[model samples]
Target: MTCIADANVLFSLLVEGHVAHEVARGWWDEQPDGAVGTCLLTRLAVLRLLTNRVAMNGTPVTPTEALGAWGRLGNDPRSVHVEAEPAIHESRFISLVSGRESTPNLWTDAWLAALAMSLDYEITTFDRGFKSFRGLRLRLLSMADK
Candidate 1:
C-alpha cells in the first residue's frame, strides 16, 4: 500500500530525530515494496525549514548534510514514491473538506489530503486537524495525543 506523508512527519525525522522518525520508518517498511510516497510540498517544507535554520544560525547547512537524512530514508529498499507535482487544485479540496464554509490555510496539508483522496492513499500524520476531514485514511503517530 502507498502512504502519503505530511511535512511534520518528514521534519520530525530530519530535525527532531527518533520517536516519530522511527515510527514513520517502521510504517513505511511495513508497506509493500515501493509504496511510500511524498508530495513536492513536503520536500519544499523540509528545505524551507533547513534554510530557516541556517539563516537563524548565520551559517548554511550544506546540501549534503541537509539531504543526508532524506537520502537515507528515501533509499530504503522498501517501495517509496515521491510526488513531484508543484500545485494542486485548492478550491476543489476546500469545497470537499469544508463545503461552503471558508477553510483556513490552503497549503500542503489540504493539497496532500486532496492528492491522497484522489489516489486512494493513506495519510501518515500526527496532526489532529486531519481528523476533521472525511474519507481520508489516517495513520497518526502514536505519540500524537500524548
Candidate 2:
C-alpha cells in the first residue's frame, strides 16, 4: 500500500538506537519502490527531534549529521517525496483544525491527516492520536519500548 510516515515513524527510522527502530525498519524495508512516502513537514520534524539535546538523551546529532541521515533515506528507491495539492488539501486541512481549540501540535497532525486522506494514502505511525481523525487510514505500529 502507498503509505506516508508520521514524524515519529520517520524519527525512529532515522535513529538506529530508537526503541521502535527495529520494527520501524522491518516495516520500512518491506515497502515496494515508491511505496513509502515523506513530506517536508514530517521530514523537518524528524530532523528537529534528531538534533534536540534533551530529546536525544544529551547526544544530539549536529544539523549536518541529521541531514546526512535524511539524505541517505531519501536516496532509497523505496522512499518517495510527496506534496499535498494545496487546492484539494487546503479545505480538508481547514475542516480538520476547525471547531476545536487545538493544541499547537494538533495543527500538524491535522495537516498530515488531511494530506493522507486527500491523497488516498495511509499514514504509518505509532501515534494512536491519528485515530481521532475520521476517514483517515492508519497503519498504527506498536512501539518497541512500550
TM-score of each: 0.70, 0.93
Model 1: lowest-lDDT 10 consecutive positions: 83-92
What are the per-residue Cα lDDT tens digits for candidate 1 across 1-146? 67887777766666544356676655554677666677667777766666565432555466676687567767866536564433454554765556434456444566787878777788888787777667888878766433
Q: Model 2 over residues 1-146: C-alpha lDDT tens digits?
A: 88889989888888888888898888887789999889999889999999999878889999999999999998999999995555689899999888968676789999999998889999999998888889999999995534
- The all-Cα superposition gives candidate 1 an RMSD in Å to the true structure of 4.2
State in Å the error of residue 16, model 2.
1.1
Which residue segments of model 2 deviate by more than 4 Å?
84-86, 144-146
Q: How far in Å is the alpha carbon of 112 misplaced in model 2?
A: 0.7
Candidate 2 structure lDDT: 0.88
